[model samples]
Target: MKQGFVKVAAATPDIRVADVWHNCEEIRKLLSEAEKEGAKVIVFPELCLTGYTCQDLFTQDILLKEARRALERIAQQTKNSGSLVFVGMPLAVDGELYNVAAALNDGRILGFTTKTFLTNYGEFYEMRQFRQGPEKARVISYEGQEIWFGPQLLYQAEEMNELIVSAEICEDVWSPVPPSIQAAREGAVILVNCSASDETVGKDSYRQELIKGQSARLMAGYVYANAGDGESTTDLVFGGHNIIAENGTILKEARRFTNEMIISEIDISRMLGERRKNTTFQTAKERNLPRISFTVNLEETRLTRRFGANPFVPQNMEERAKRCEEILMIQAMGLKKRLLHTNSKTAVVGISGGLDSTLALLVTAKAFDMAGKKRKDIIAVTMPCFGTTDRTYHNACLMSEKLGATLREVPIADAVRTHFRDIGHDEDVHDVTYENAQARERTQVLMDIANQEMGMVIGTGDMSELALGWATYNGDHMSMYGVNASVPKTLVIHLVKYYADTCEDAELRAVLLDVLDTPVSPELLPPKDGEIAQKTEDLVGPYELHDFYLYYVLRFGFEPGKIYRLAKIAFEEQYDDETILKWLRTFYRRFFTQQFKRSCLPDGPKIGTVALSPRGDWRMPSDACAAVWMKDLENLTFNKTGGYSL
Candidate 1:
């Protein structure tokens, strides 16, 4: 019931063939349960009141009269329930019978959307009994009330925006053009289907896929309830399958052949945003569409769908491997083209044995190979300064040699010492200037060497770095072409390991595995007693939290409060509420203040869905005000070093 979120359900109730009274009772019971669950709209199977398998019995006046009477009973039972229900039944319209999904709510029939595509092939002989429905809706008298009955009928929720719902019959969805598509164009946020699709070998998967794709195509919430476990087994098997999906994602699904109710909240906000962003979706809006109006009470709904803390990273191992392979190829191929197009035989990459640099160097090797150049053409430069660690230094040199790249070390301590003297800053003071001086000096060395060698300077800074403005402008931030520009820090580690695991060299793989295990740091400050200092997370925020913030902020344009709400669920075990909010504030502050860095980013491949490349996804002004965002975060009240404000 939340603004832009509507609770919807797909219900498959067990029933007997030709049992109108019994089936109507089951519908009533399910309606009561769904309403209690705060479901605004619930859908049942096709011809559910009279049962889809009631073959020749549909022609009998008694069965047809019973179905009409049962529809009345179901409609009457909805008096105490607030849910808009879509239950299937047989209907006689203009002296012809058709399968219709009647919309019932608050003891009244809102409308009936009849099936347009009557199945007449194979085990399905729907056309034998019922004929195709008309395209245009017409008013009909049902239970002493006039209601619209046809394919194009939309229910408008009186209390909610974008909570409009519509219904379609079984074969209507299987038609060349689904009613869901038109329903969406007509502003129906929710599309319910009453399906009595008989199960066959591999039919469940196809049914599932069809519904999911339609939801995605329409950018609407799709609730599919199929008839199951009941009806005649003569030549057809009905395995009741139910699913609730939004934006192509199936949030809740029942086991095939089981009578169950699947419910989930549909974030119309996300779908609406996607449709607005895609031009094809916008074109669908221009066509004139007919709609039947219905309404529901507006109230806040509880979130049921689980949010992933690391949405960028896949949860399953198989998907993760696939994603890792795909992203690695994308990165390498991007760099490959840049090198071949520029006719550069050598690539200049600054390596510190850190994740970002290591990934960049690997990509350079792949790019050179793709360009039909030797690996040594990649000029791997390790600039050791005040913060350089022996472990990373050794690893950088080893990694370069292992990849057959030309390893070169340039000590920047002497040059930074001179720059420190010029800036009148003491080397003892570890500040932004101290760190940025080493960064800029290293960049100068790489750029000049690239110019001398006639190569491209590879950039190691990732999207996470760019989001926080972690790089020094015209220093590490500048490069000829950045392959990891769109890659987030959370994903960079995974991609590196993915490349490592597939390497033919075991030693190289072992070293990469260790690098993956290493803590993330710029390593700008000198080590404290041989231990690495200046861990990036300690200064800014955890990449996990910041990545979460960046994703929701840019991907969905979610408000800070909504993002915070989702974060609690996503990171429940890893982080508490207070900790999440604290880092969230940090993310907003740094992201706003660092836009100046992103404004002048060098050429980089857009690798992911969310990117802030000046020429790509994000084009914000460097000086945009974050005052309002920061103020909202700052005002978040928490307990005294405890959990959220309870």
Candidate 2:
């Protein structure tokens, strides 16, 4: 598998009970279908060679003989398929019957992984006909060929070292210590379960959750294939419920009562990166598990997995609203603790009627409420300079009055001009110095007012600005406490809207709604015809794209090429390839060059997994080079017609 992505499938073939030849034919057909779809690893239901419903007939010599022949035929059929297949059957080893999942590839039986935990309770009587497999692996003669037979067989791909696979039967996973646990600790990235779980009322949900939880716990990909229709429904009905999951998220799930094959590409590199980050996931001290290697042609897998355009914000409205509420409470609580510890009597917030400032003011009010302080003691200041717009100024004053916070207006145009004259800079030259001077003057006003009022100046810059180093150093960047430090720009809009929708005061809600509708800008440059002239997105690209790049880069540590591929898929409908690549390059350059600002960031709470807290989740050196990452992007060629090639 190339790029550590291998397409895998979980197939539930329809088969008759005790009909070995028919079951083999169905398995071969499904296997061929999966092969055509470019699946490198395929798994089938347990005991499919002879259906799990074959209760007493399992002891018959004719059925066992036919099953052996069927296994050979399946193995022969996979000679040119180039897919590693796992099928189930009852095998006789050393005069004892064992329910086993046989691993076949390239006309050979690579290994046989037997069921470690037999299901003897409830409707299952597997212990009655089969013995539990041995804990240690051993070579056994099967049909004149020596095959590794045990419960701890690992199927590793020679092409990609991270594409290590392991198998376990149905009941084994249900047990407390699943064989997959050891397999994962021993370096298995993908775990396949050959399950024959019969259908019952409400059992499917539990089964699905169990598979998801196991994948999450082991930090590996899981493929589950269950038996389906065509089995003799003498006492129970098996509904083919196939599922493919990676690291707790289910990529594909087949509907019940319909024999379906579910296919999805597993991201082995992501799982390995997660493992590398998690300190608790320790590797086994004794690496004694038998490793069975298989060869497959390496190629980039066609991704069918869905990557959400907005990773920080949830897609579902209900879930998004819930998340927004929880995040607000978390931000408020963090600020509340800081205020209580500092014993401050007031909290000062610079209100610009912009998204970040609006959110900061709301959080400050919430913190005051949580700390049992008066809202009047919360100072809301609006600093108007040359770039101040009438609409934003009006909204700022109205919102402060409606929230019952003491509002103050500080016009800094005169102070900035005096400073400009002292520095011998032209007053008409609107450049970086002109913009940063206004920002620093506003910060000075806020800080001095906080000191005069016995309060703390709450920072308004969000995580997105911090990532791109968009905030002026020691200007809007410096504050006593940053409430929205970990929040991205994409999520800030949603959080403010959530509050507006839930607030009881109609006037306050109206102002918040207006603020959400206003364009994102820093208002550093002079206005054009009294309208805002400096748009942040127009210069730094869309925050949505930058946030997407930030998430993949920081959360998973994915390479630039891989992140670009995922971005193209996620934003295909909204942005062209050239636009995405352009912004992506900008994001990388800014993120690398701006680390010095983040190196000495103020204290803030981490709201999500992707945070830039220097002392916390991210600890990158300020002087790290971006040449290697930039070179990767430069190698990609993009055409004018929204197409790209690497």
- Candidate 1's clash total is 8
lDDT of 2 by residue, 1-646 (tens): 5557889999998898999999999999999999989999999999999998899899999999999999999999889677889999999988899999999998889999999999998888888899999989999987788889998799888767678899999988889999999999999999999999999999999998999999999999999999999877878999998999999989999999999899999999999999999999998998999999887778768988889999999999999999998999999999999999998989999999899999999998888898899999989999999889998999999999988899999999999999999999898999999999999999999999999998899999999999999999999999999999999999999999999999999989999999988889999888899898999999999999999999999999998888889999999899988899899999999999999999999998889989999999899999999999999999898777758757
TM-score of 1: 0.97
Question: In terms of TM-score, how similar is model 2 to the real structure?
Answer: 0.99
Best candidate according to lDDT = 2
Off by over 4 Å in 2: 639-642
Q: Each candidate: what lDDT? A: 0.85, 0.92
Worst 10 residues of 2 by lDDT: 637-646
lDDT score at residue 255, model 1, on the 0-100 scale: 86
